[model samples]
Target chain A: MVQKYTSMAYASADDLVFGKAKFPVKAGLGLEIGAGYTTPEINYAPRPQAGKSKEKLIKEYERITTDSMQRMVQIGAPSVVLETEHVEQMTNNPSWGGEVAHAQKTIMEEYHDEYGIKCALRHTPGDIREDRDFLKLRGDKYDLLMESFEQIAQNGADLLSIESMGGKEVFDYSILRNDTAGILFGIGVLGSMDMEMIWSDIADIAKKNNVVAAGDTDCAQANTAMFIAGGLLDKNLAHTIAIVARAISAGRSLCAYEAGATGPGKDCGYENTIIKSISGVPIAQEGKSSTCAHSDVMGNLVMQACDLWSNESVEYHGEFGGTSVQCWGESLAYDCSLMNVALKTGKEKGLRDLFTLSDKYRDPQGYVLAYENAYRVGQAIVKDGTDNYLRTKNAAVECCTILDEGIASGKLRLTRFETKALAKVQADLAALPDNSDQFMSDCLTKYKEEVAVFRPENYGL
Target chain B: MLDLKKEDIDGILIRYNVSLEKEMTPDEAAEELYPKDELIYPIAKAIYEGEEDDVIDGLKAAIDAGKNPIALINDALMVGMGVVSQLYDEGIIFLPNVMMSADAMLDGIEYCKDQTDEVPEPKGTVVCHVAEGDVHDIGKNIVAALLRANGFDVVDLGRDCPVDEVIEAVEKEKPILVTGTALMTTTMYAFKEVNDKLLEKGIKVPFACGGGAVNQDFVSQYELGVYGEEAADAPKIAEFILASGDGIEKLREEFHKH
Candidate 1:
């Protein structure tokens, strides 16, 4: 039997009913979806609206979640991974760690385990920067955050795709001041500096507790918030994607696309555009596309040749507009680091040059065409490929060359986004406590079978 | 990448280049950010629609062309800022763009001021601080910048400031208005601490307080406190306080019921 792949797809309530979405191809891999009350923004109701009662919120989760999981089974998903949280921590309702295990054991394993279908749970500690209560309290927040991280791991999640918030400054201040609740960072605030400090620190904490650290791109989240709700941020997709792909390439773990509900059109909706800064300045493509489009699907291939950026292995939901096999949508994060661009800015010449591939694949519909093509290749690779170590190394060398060419001429200037990314790969080599250096090796080891087939290489450095 | 001819390259640097993959035109973008009157079209066109050089070059050209410095400030610079404020208010632009615009606007303001003999005193003196123990001052900074943009003398005390420091600054500055921001529920209590101290000293200071954590209920609990729901309202509130003779209580009557 082959090991399961991490490229996940989801089952949305709206799509399962209206779209007649099929099950993601259960090549016996992970089936994950972004949804429900998993993100801070989605669960946290706007102020003055008086959040729903604990009972009502729980009932809503129950309704959406059970239907979603059942859709996985109906679609013949080989295995399922559920993303959830106990209660909306930002709200008045108080629930804690056990709900994670309960969901895993009851909502997930109970039904699928019978058919030898593996099931798991994913968790995003949903904390928004705008949440008033979240901004306060030093240690309780950390303990709560850690509690969720440890709980999911303990409850036997096949993969604990963790979500995080807070900057190194706040983390350090919290540590130095003996303040427990760290400063609230809107998601995707982690930078190269933060990775050097806080990310490694958290990685250490995760390692100590044997938790899997899932890395995600900040651009998808930032763009989603920018397009949907205006705020101050950088919306460059190429720059952000390069940074995230590098981070994952260097061993940050699985590419977790959590949050974002919608994206720019795959074909005719929004014209092909580059990622713009928060103030609406157009820069080159920095990271992922704004919506579920070709750039995003292509981004997965770019990362997958290195790490798990998209779920190759799931139930389909019609709502997202992704094709039937398995659908990995996008991430929804609101990053708040807009103060540093004037001194130096992110420039994306080479990365933009690489995304010319997305343009080339833009036949009929750019994003949709790419998405469909990627899954087709994914299905074939999963089923027919031979697992050989030498062959894997050969494939890895080719991917490395592809990545090298992609980033060879690119640079993200402000806050040193590109330089910092390249530095992270070399710096990881210096062997900080986070084991930043051994990430590529670890990727090779973790997916040796995949390495034989995918021939993954670290494009980060 | 751009493959632009001389015209296209110069095109972007001049007015708001309308072809940068955005749906709206530069003029429409400016109108949406700040929808006041026709006077601001030039400066707003430069700062919002045009690039950084576009903004600076536009201002320099105006000054060289014999436009009065103060008229430029009132009609163009300040008006452009009004749109910047509105853009931020309406969620049309985020902080990064606002900061970039603010920088461009200040650059113009400074150059124009150099051309004049006496720089006009700002609208009023308003002291601002983040409540003690709250390091999240992104909101407070936005308010202080807008206040400065509106020609207010802002004595900005950075975030996590002690309550005593707030009172000390109030005593020293004796500004027409004061503002405090708190992004944490636990730390917002410091707003009351500073207010009560000011009240004890019989300082009829106007303190407007608001942030992620401080609600209208929390802000209204103090004697001199007025709830600041939005940072964009800083200029108007300071103007109101100066006009109302620093009447803190009147803030509740005028600004509330939003």
Candidate 2:
């Protein structure tokens, strides 16, 4: 059975320092994440043409893996995480994913034995159930997803992670309308149920294989909001709504840790900051450095308390300076080096402040993600921790309150439209009944009719 | 225009993080926020502020003043949205501001349509959808809205629409163009499946695919695929399709950066 976090591992926000965690998990080669120093987690994908043949795919993986580790060795990276996000082709063909994982792990082992460079392979299989009706979460594709996870763990992967897509159907609908209650029902309740179901099995797989079930990310929910809010492409979704959705996602992602995932959660989960504060586990964060994969407003600020600094993901190709992995590896390694230097000089807090203040006021998303605000959201989550619905609702309320205060105090800048949105979101959240059962039932009756794809039965309502 | 004192205007500038020139006046700052024409200012400001009721009031006043409703849409409503888009591009404004402004502009357009007895012909028809199995549709939604704003009739196929549904929509709607967005690598392959099915059926509607996981290379590999680098590019692509007579290579040549 999973034990839900009811209290914070750190006494206060001040105690939540970078490169240190109250709960650290040791993985391959006796390397410890979230124990003493931050490490670079490098993620890359094979070129598109590799999908044409299994041989080409494996060969591409081998090239990128060896190339990245060699650069890590040259950079003298203390420890590195290589996240292999299995493409859809691999999930459909489970054996292909296993072979790729085995090959990459073998490369990691060879590098470690040769140069004393510690590394871990985080095998992230695609959530194949999303290919169809993810609501059912049981079918040939679902079976393949689970089997792929087990296969990778047994094939020398040190950590396991998946950007699971549970409750995304409803999240997509609710976020478009900026419906806070609907979002709560979708991510808070439906997403938690899916996380518990999947992570319970994944936790067992990790235990059986003696590997760490790292964590899950709210990529489908929160990251979608972040992407929409960051660029000028989509203007319908509010940054205020995105920030609140991120806080709500904390409850959903927390289910993974509750179900036995240890430390160093996935990199793309901007919600990992709050999860780190709540669960006190090592977290992998991607920020300004992640521009190779995507852009965001909080690149500098996200580094405030990360244990594993990542470049999100870069394609396996060459750049002007070097291959994508080599170039991004140096970028990530240098960032880690700065933090390590700060830790050595006992100036970690000073460096953390610079990171936090630089991007805090640039966007509401960044303001809420600042470590101080994340801790507040964390406190709100744990205050109602036992109840998934209530915890997420509390987190959203805290985020809104934080933004409201920031705007009122003239610390956070927002346009007139954004200010109006913040008010509307706060009012909408306030309108929801404080009772979780009432909120869930009301959302069920409402969203069932409003959202065509939403079914309460999928969430075990 | 915006009947605000200097303090209120300064407060607006501060809230939006807009720096004024050393000696710029509050009037100039207001003009910077929206157009400064007597007839267009109120409507533009209403749209910029996303005030739907005010937009309606401004449109009613413009109509009473014997202004052409369609001209108001082109000059005032679209112009106001243009300002909002520019502010967003400059990072002075954000998504919520754009959404509200879009809502206000659309409302103004609807009001203008109500005032006119003759139906305004749309430039063309387009069908937009998020790729199958991918529920991230904000990009699709924005593209659809922009297309509608540019006077195109958009048949919106909402998020996670299956491949069959897309093909069915195309066959039924007979749209001039179709677009697909996918934010995940796993789901992006569904775009290829969609294009292939369209090819098998001999439906040669120009297909524009984009999103985080999609690139020009992936789209170029398939026939009838035009990569959209931004949501703003959708309407331009639709215009290009209408003008160029559905040539995929030309459409790609004009739009795809890489």
How high is each candidate's interface RMSD, in Å?
A: 13.8, 10.5
Report the poorest 10 consecutive residues by lDDT, candidate 2 chain B: B13-22
Overall lDDT per candidate, in order of appearance: 0.40, 0.82
TM-score of chain A of 2: 0.97
Tens digits of per-residue lDDT for model 2, A1-461 = 87888998788888777898889889876689988799999988777567767899899999999999999988788788898888777876888888999999999999999998878888888877744333556566667888998888888889988988788778876675566777878788889988998898898899999999999999988888787666423444667788889999999999999998996899999998899899989999999888989988788989999999999888789899789999998899999999999999999988898788767776788889888889999999999899988899899999998998887776565765566678888888888888877887787788888677676655566
A1-461: candidate 1 lDDT, tens digit per residue: 11222222322111211001122111112332221101101111112211234444344444444554554455554334444433334211124333434443465555665555444444444332222222422345545554555655555433333223323223222211111111111121122222233234334444565544433223222222222222112221123222222221111111121111011101111111210000011111212322222123233112111101122112222445333222331221110011111112432233223333333221111221122222322222222122211211222222223333333523101223222333433333233222323433543344334212221211122
Pick the DockQ winner.
2
Q: Cα miss at A32, model 1 (Å)? A: 16
Taking chain B only, the TM-score of every model is 0.76, 0.77
TM-score of each: 0.43, 0.81
Give stretches of model 2 more than 4 Å off.
Answer: A131-134, A138-140, A231-236, B1-123, B127-138, B141-174, B184-205, B216-225, B243-258
The lDDT leader among the candidates is 2
Candidate 1 segments exceeding 4 Å error: A1-200, A206-461, B1-44, B48-52, B65-71, B82-100
